[model samples]
Target chain A: MNDALPPSNQTQHSSDQDKPNTPITPNTRRILLVCRTAPYGNALARESLETALAAGAIGAKVAMLFLDEGVWQLAQHQKPQGIGRKNHSAMLGALPLYDIDTVLVDRDSLSKRCIDLAELGDFTQLIDSLQVKEVIADHDVILSF
Target chain B: MTLHTVNKSPYLSQCLADCLDRVSAGDSIVLIEDGVYGINCATSETLSALNKAIAQLMTLGVQFCALRPDIEARGLQTTSANCPFNLLSDGDFVDLVCEADKVLSWY
Candidate 1:
């Protein structure tokens, strides 16, 4: 039997909460991380979130775009307790603290999966195919996970 | 140009199709690991549909490639004359990765 507990907010000290946002210089790389996997049953989704936070921590301007099954990471009321996994959405809710404020979602992917935008919260910006194309062209670095 | 690597089979996953959908005109897609199955004669409905999508991307100048080592490991038969995409050795794959400004791996 496993007794491991999910990550807690205690790690984010109150002092750490007030840390100044990482400044982006003129030369800062605009990175786009396209996440296309679902949460749980695999580590890809968590890894994608970690990459976005890590990149943001290093002062790179980062944008996280969720497409296909990746949108599941943004699904509301996720209960991973039964599965013995951490709450994926809780980790995502911490993106802004790391300065990762840009989160895009493919409207088509959402529609196909029948997921309403309200369910994902207002943190995500809905983007169409044309917008997705433009976003891909705008980024200096694109990493798909 | 971006170097996109798809390491999953078209028959088993949606990685290749999704990658093709988002790729721009100048991007290159390298098929590695199980992705080599993409070029294995499209006799099924799924492969045919995926092949059509790939064909459309090819017309837009998206170069497709597969790793030779993985192909050999999977015992995939590919003669240059009949193969649709470039069969790359380990060194060539490294070169392709070096040439691209960024890389996106579809696992």
Candidate 2:
């Protein structure tokens, strides 16, 4: 954790400090949520999705990039119930409802894993390694999960 | 038999080689997560030596398997006639863990 940045909750209310009585202003910063972990085996994947949803709810301009094992979260036909966990892919389908429309998937990560677009559905913008650098450069704030 | 699991990419970490050094002829090795990238064309001498070590271990009766999901996620083809290791499904991975006397993870 970097000491320079405030915690998530603090960042959420940072805009309201000057006008305590007023409602929090809609966030204007462009946030890129970078997810790079596999789902089910750990909590990072779920935590990253929750963070994205939270930021989106605050009216922040949010986009998501699924890289490395993070692409596994987008895989279809996931039946996590046997493992006593909710279906992560189903949760991802809710991103658009939260106004997180700019979901990106690393093309190299998917191809390296043998996953085709059909397996991941049609919700994301596929980006190559170079485009990944461009997308990062385009964002104002990057939150890795 | 021991089951040694490697989950870090050999290109970026020392986990695979360290695991290789510790594995015996009868121990089993299962590549998972980024470790599955080991099957890709070697990009360094260390990786080539690791591959050679894996092959030599196989000749000495060491069983090697890579997780099917991780392998497929990385788009690696283990079904080819010349593929070096076997692919294990999640259930099979569970079985491999149960069959081994001990399990060591290098991640």
Candidate 3:
């Protein structure tokens, strides 16, 4: 069985020192959080939101852009209240308060889903697919969720 | 003139191997999504196999890249934890695009 290997042994990730602290200090470092899914679906989706919120709270200049299927996350008039949830809709509203104001929604995705901005609240911004690559160009860090 | 993107996971094998198999040796592979999970695994034979394939590709001049955020999101910020791969940001991703003749998504 010497040739046999374990299941956990995978590829190599980055070093620990590269990880930032809980309160990421805003330096000249620019970050982009790519939100490609709706909220409350999986851990990654929530984690991406948390990272954006945390980064923004710490005065980090961050942008939250949604593309592909992610456009559904910012839909207007969410009523998860019936599930006895925290009204994620409200929590979503807090993004701007936390300085996570730069929200980008793909225009093509909107047309694909037939989503209307009038339904999504005034906080959301619609962008085209071409602009996304350009936007990613300006950031120092890109976090795709 | 070539971009290095890594598809280190078999899950994306179709996304990459399907469309990317036709790509010449100069193309790159950037591991994102479940791709970054390869960091510091539990000594699984699968990890070893993936690493071997990656090594072969590297020898052939295929670039392998692991997105920074994907690694961090998995709480792999421990650096010395498990998997060791290159890091790239959105700006880096953009620079790659600018460097490459064209960019294709595996998944």
TM-score of each: 0.82, 0.51, 0.52
Q: Which prediction has more favorable DockQ, 1 or 3? A: 1
Comparing 2 and 3 on lDDT, the stronger one: 2
The segments of candidate 1 whose C-alpha lies over 4 angstroms from its true place after superposition are A1-27, B41-46, B79-83
The lDDT-based order of candidates, best leading, equals 1, 2, 3
**Number of the predicted model whose DockQ against the real structure is largest:** 1
TM-score head-to-head 1 vs 3, winner = 1
The C-alpha stretches of model 2 lying farther than 4 A from their native spots are: A1-26, B1-107
Candidate 1: clashing pairs of residues: none
Q: Which tens-of-lDDT digit does each residue in B1-107 have in candidate 1?
A: 88889988888888887888888997898999999877663334656776677777778998988899998888887643644588899999999999998888888
Model 1: per-residue lDDT, tens digit, A1-145?
1224334544455446456773445337788999988999689899989888778878878999998899999998999999999999989988878888899999999999998778986677999987887788788888777
| Predicted complexes: DockQ each | 0.49, 0.03, 0.03
RMSD of 3: 18.6
lDDT of each: 0.83, 0.78, 0.61
> What's the candidate order when arranged by decreasing DockQ?
1, 3, 2
| Best TM-score among the predictions, by candidate number | 1
lDDT of 1 at B55: 71
